[model samples]
Target chain A: MFRTISNPWISLASRLILAAVFIYASIDKIAHPDLFAEVVHNYRILPIATENLFAMALPWIELGTGVLLLLGLLTRSAALLSAFMLIVFIAAIGAGLWRGIDITCGCFTVSSEGRQLGWLTLLEDVALLLPSFQLLLTAHPGISLDRRYLPASPLSAEPR
Target chain B: MKDWVAAHRGKATIAGAVLIVCVFGSIGLLRNAVAEHPLAWVAKPPVLVKYDRAVRPSPDALQTVTLEDAAGMAFDAGALFVDARTAEEYAAGHIQGAVNLPTNHYDDELPAVAARLEGMTLIVYCDGGACEASLQVARRLLKSGYAPVVVFTGGWPEWQGAGYPTEAGGTPSP
Candidate 1:
């Protein structure tokens, strides 16, 4: 399974799906940063001083990474970033559940209407996170903008 | 592992962080530079709220009411009690004179409450201290011109726990 995922075609498919999910998740947060910030506050994880900064800045980071990943520009770095974020999200969700903080998941929206954190949300993040982590570890150089524009560095060159 | 770091992780991590900062930070700063106020990331809540006449009252604006206080105010026509739990939760049971204005659905419910609730001391509450719906709803109400509004931090559970006045179903008592 691990070797199969590292195959270029499989990697490309996984990349596209993961990029789409991130891009989709980012739009609501970017559009409603204030609400998103409020949702972050509800989690009671970050201190009050940092909530606004994280909410305002994170969507853009997600958006940038998603776009780059979609274009296969800076593929490995984007994969690493997205994987790191997923891990953080997993931790946040787990913390909220452990502490029994009943708040909106804020995974997809700024609204607390119906999206509360639970075991299912945790499972979903883990499922999604695996591909991102796999992409980073495998680091496949496929049909990518990074491949097209920037060729191999001397470090990546094969020794005879 | 060491070889991979020398090849990949070393430059990539720095590049990613720098890229996010330079791009997003500039956009957020630019938006704040032109808008009515700095956007959330740059705007300190205290600074923004320092001298502004409150649109809604904070919990600190007045003492949080106890079951006794709420019971006494329940009969007053001018005392506005707001339940900040969900409609379903409110429907299940709430303080007798309180109306639902859940944080989740505040935008939908605000106009009606705002128009009719002027001159009333709005007392917002939810499912007790662990619930933030009340706090969020209270802030929105303040922003929407609900003055003298204060939170009852001990919300429904506290009121119910004390066997204070409560009624079930969606409608508020007249």
Candidate 2:
């Protein structure tokens, strides 16, 4: 499982998949900042004032990292950030559940994904995390812009 | 954990952290420049109860009213129980004698639910556990002239899960 998935082609596929997800997830949020802000407020996690800020910014962060991952440029950075973000997402949802705060918006996602316990449990969280962790760990993910632009060295090139 | 971090260790992890900070930080800066707003870590809305009731929030009914409190007032003719879940969720099952008035549909539900709740302590609730509908509905009720409403934040699922009386079907039985 590990070797098959870690191959350049598989790693590239994983990176693109994670990228597409983050990109797709961020679109509606960026378009509807107000609704997103209200959703954030509903979690009751952040102060009333900061809700708008997160609403304003999180989608962009997702978009930026997602684009980088999709292009196989900054693959490691993008995937690492993606993994960290998922960890935060899981924690936020978990904390909301623990505190009994009612994080749902309507169907799925608190901030764009996995707002409900059922949604989180039904692979939304883990499915997203798997590729990101793969991207973070796999060296020299293929079809990478980094490989082209940064030139050869184990640090920036094919593994020795 | 250490092993995992060590495997990914290199400039990539450092760069990722920096990029994330820079991007998120830019958001913060832009927000401050274009729009200024207060930032609180998290804010808890108060649970408002009627004046005749003890001014002190019953330990039972802070941001969330306990299941026991919900049951204690379940059948009180004078206490209005409002379910903030979707009509479908209410139909699936809910606290017996609780009226469906989902927060999202507040405007549509207000006139009728409000009329029924006149002069009574309103208990706003939903399916519970991070379900904001209860809080949102409760606040809306407060905004819509219902004062001192209690958020049964423990909500419908909790009430039902505890083996309390429940009712189901298209029409809520309040």
Candidate 3:
């Protein structure tokens, strides 16, 4: 549904939720860098050196995008980035499942002890994708900093 | 209806769709290109260290080792058999030659056990399939540079079933 948002509050709430998810996920991974690296390794994706780099950098990217989304600054850009990340995650999980490699998804945690990539992980990613897509499709909410710093209409336009 | 057509007709939905396709398609292509390289991020196995160094024999290591073949290998004359179960279980019964290594405290006391069984084949075992202490103990032995670590994967269950010589209580006589 591409219909424009008539209610800005709904849009703002959704943006917050999306941002919170990204920020929360990033913090957990940051806390356990080594374990996260192992999880990334379990995916069997990426060169050895690159896996370490990704394990170090990807969480920050997620955190940055999330903060932007929460602030509603460049909302569309943040949503797009989040969507791209989620899509990549889903694809990786799907590939792991297809190959029958039992490993942790590492989206949430880096530990391989109890985690397993399966249908449920894919579903969670898809759920995150929906809210991100919604933010992308709707206009920036009026309550956001985007509205404050860069109003949709020209600054000279008569105040509503 | 007429007003709607007039407003929407020039929006060029097809061009928009094509632009979306091109962007996503290019991204997909780029991803594929990176993935195709053997050195791509996803191509390598994760690095990890093994806790044990017994060097698990590869499937192709010997091709096959039948009971007769196993028997043919020189048994270490002075090697001691170490049972890694609890004392109570050890008291109930155990392999005739096995001394209690009791893996529950295996980590802390392995050195002492090893010293007693110095220059001996430390065959380690636990209850059975569900037991991991045997493997843990075996790993410890290997780490300590104990030679020729043999793990009876089937452990006590197999030993008892095979009707091998067994004994009860404190350290059976050699």
The candidate that wins on DockQ is: 1
For model 3, the superposed segments whose C-alpha errors exceed 4 Å read: A4-6, A153-160, B1-174
Best by lDDT: 1
Q: Residues A1-160, candidate 1, lDDT per residue (tens digit)? A: 7567677776677678888988899888877777788788777788787887777778877888788878877676677777778889999999999999878898887765757899999998889887776666664646767666644531111110
Residue A51 alpha-carbon offset, candidate 3, angstroms: 0.8
Q: Which ten residues in a row have the lowest lDDT in candidate 1 chain A?
A: A151-160
* Interface RMSD, per-candidate values to 1 decimal: 4.5, 6.3, 12.0
Query: First chain of model 2: TM-score?
Result: 0.82
Pairwise DockQ winner, candidates 1 and 2: 1
Q: Candidates' lDDT values, in order?
A: 0.72, 0.67, 0.61
lDDT of 1: 0.72
Please give, as one word, the docking class of candidate 3: incorrect
Model 1: residue B9 alpha-carbon error in angstroms: 5.9
Q: Kindly report which residue stretches of model 2 are placed more than 4 angstroms away from their true locations once superposed.
A: A1-7, A27-59, A90-108, A111-115, A118-124, A152-160, B1-9, B28-81, B92-99, B104-123, B127-132, B141-167, B172-174
Off by over 4 Å in 1: A1-3, A153-160, B1-10, B25-29, B32-63
Ranked by DockQ, top first: 1, 2, 3
Instruction: Tell me the RMSD of model 3 versus the true structure.
Output: 11.7
lDDT of 1 by residue, B24-128 (tens): 656654654565634555434431122222354344443356666666676778787899888888899988877888786677887766655788878888988
lDDT string, candidate 3, B1-174, tens digits:
434423442232223323333454344334334442212334233222222334564321211122222222225465566777776688899877677776435555566555667776566777766455566466557657776565655677876876766788765665
The TM-scores of all predictions, comma-separated, are 0.84, 0.60, 0.50
lDDT by residue for model 2 over B1-174, one digit each (tens)? Answer: 435444655764666567775876576446545543433333345444433365645532334467777677766767778888878788898777778887655676777766677888778887676666777677667657675577776676677778887778877664
